[model samples]
Target: MKTAICYYSRHHGNTRKVLEAMAGEGDIDLIDVTTRQVVRLEAYDCIGFASGIYGFEFHKGVVSFARQYLPEGKPVFFVYTYGGARGNGAKTMEALAREKGCLVLGEFSCKGYDTFGPFKLVGGLSKGHPDAQDLEDARRFYRDLVKRFSGGAQA
Candidate 1:
């Protein structure tokens, strides 16, 4: 299946790190929403939304990109990074995808080094996160998604 991952990774690039690891595992197209605002998703069998948590949600750039570009009835997955252990980043993205008629496959989330706002005063939260282990886990998650999607599973 032709897969594409549309991501917005700013600040410490935590989300990108995980994505790169996933790419190493298999062939996947990575599109940076910050640079490329418009992309044709019709050709992709599987699509992924990825971003870092901001204010307890997925980055606005990613959200906007999905809202504007995601096609109906496509299989979708999510990958996100957050400073806090608890966040609704993926949930919000899932809702948007569903609203657009995309089928939710699964999601992956992990802690990322964060120094946004007050966290910066304390030298950051979840420092050194999205570490080697986290990246490996993301790769595993991608592999699982590939297997599941390729098994003739419908959205």
Candidate 2:
């Protein structure tokens, strides 16, 4: 199946590191939201929205892309990197995807080095994260997500 990952990875690009590892092995298209506006999402059979958590939320660019261009009824997945163990940002994005009438196949999240606001004071939470293990977990998550979506597996 055709797959696309549109993401916004600012700061240290830790989120992008995870995506890059996954994309290197899968037949996926990667789009950096900073460089391109997603005008069309219907071109792919599956799309993955990814970003680094910002203020306990998905990045503004990724959220806006979903609001503006996520195609109705298409299968979509989510990937996010956050310093927190809980994935509140991913959940928020999932809700938005549901509101847009897209099927949420699955989601993947991992701890990334935090560089947002006050986290910097603590030398950033989960420093040096989206580390080797985190990247491996992300790849495994993406692999499973692809199988579920392409193989007609259930949630």
Candidate 3:
């Protein structure tokens, strides 16, 4: 499958680590939203939108990308990293994807080191996160997602 992962990873780059690990597992194209603007989504069989959660939501850039460029009738998945365990950003993204006529395949997320805003005051929540274990879990999640999406087709 021609798959692409378009992501925005700032701050501690925890989200990027997950995507990188996933990239090694498949022939997935990686696009950093900070550097490249996604103009067309139809070029890929599947697309994965990833980002770090901010203010209990997806980064503004990620939301904007989904709203503006997520093509219709394509399969899409979400990957995110958050500080707090509780949040509905991924669900909200899923809803948006459905509204856009995209198939919701699956999602992957984990608790990354929190160094944003208020979390910085207390030395962050789950400090030193997106650690080795988190990366491994992300790798597993990515592998499962790929398998499910491929229907056991060759990677």
Candidate 4:
């Protein structure tokens, strides 16, 4: 299946690192919403949203991008990175995808090296994250996603 991973990874590149692991395994299109102005999700069978958790949610750019471009009835999954443990980080994206008639496939979240705001004074939270194990886990998640979405089979 043709897959596209649209992400915002500027804070510490935690999500990007995981995406690289997936790319190394296969040919998947990667879209950096930080730079790209337009994304064509209609051409892909599955879409993956990746971002560093910001203010308890996805980066605003990604939210806007998906609201404007995600194709209807497509299968969608999420990949997220955060300074804290996962909670409802994917909730916003999931809701939006569902509103647009996309099937919610699942999500992957891992801690990332973060020193944002107050944490900067003490260095950071989740330091040295998106580590080897985290990447490996992400690879496994990607593999499962591929198996689940292969050949354009609907969910």
Q: Candidate 1, TM-score vs. the true structure?
A: 0.94
Candidate 3: tens digits of C-alpha lDDT, residues 1-155: 67888889988988898899888877789887777553677898888999888777777788778887888878888999999864776877888888988888888888888867777898888787778888888788777877887784322
Name the lDDT value of residue 114 in candidate 3.
84
Which residue pairs collide, candidate 4? none
lDDT per residue as tens, model 1, 8-43: 998999999999999887778999998865589999
Model 4, 1-155: lDDT tens per residue?
78898999987888899899877766689999878666678898788998989888998889988998898898999999999756569999999998998998889899999888899999999989989999999989888878876745476
Taking the tens digit of each residue's C-alpha lDDT, what string does model 2 give over 12-70? 88878999988976888888887865357788888899998777788889988878778
The lDDT for every candidate, in the order shown, is: 0.88, 0.82, 0.82, 0.87
Backbone Cα, N, C clashes tallied per candidate: 0, 0, 0, 0
Winner on TM-score between 1 and 4 is 1
* Index of the highest-TM-score prediction: 1
Residue pairs clashing in model 3 are none
Runs of candidate 3 with Cα error greater than 4 angstroms are 36-38, 152-155
Candidate 1 residue 41 Cα shift, in angstroms, is 1.0
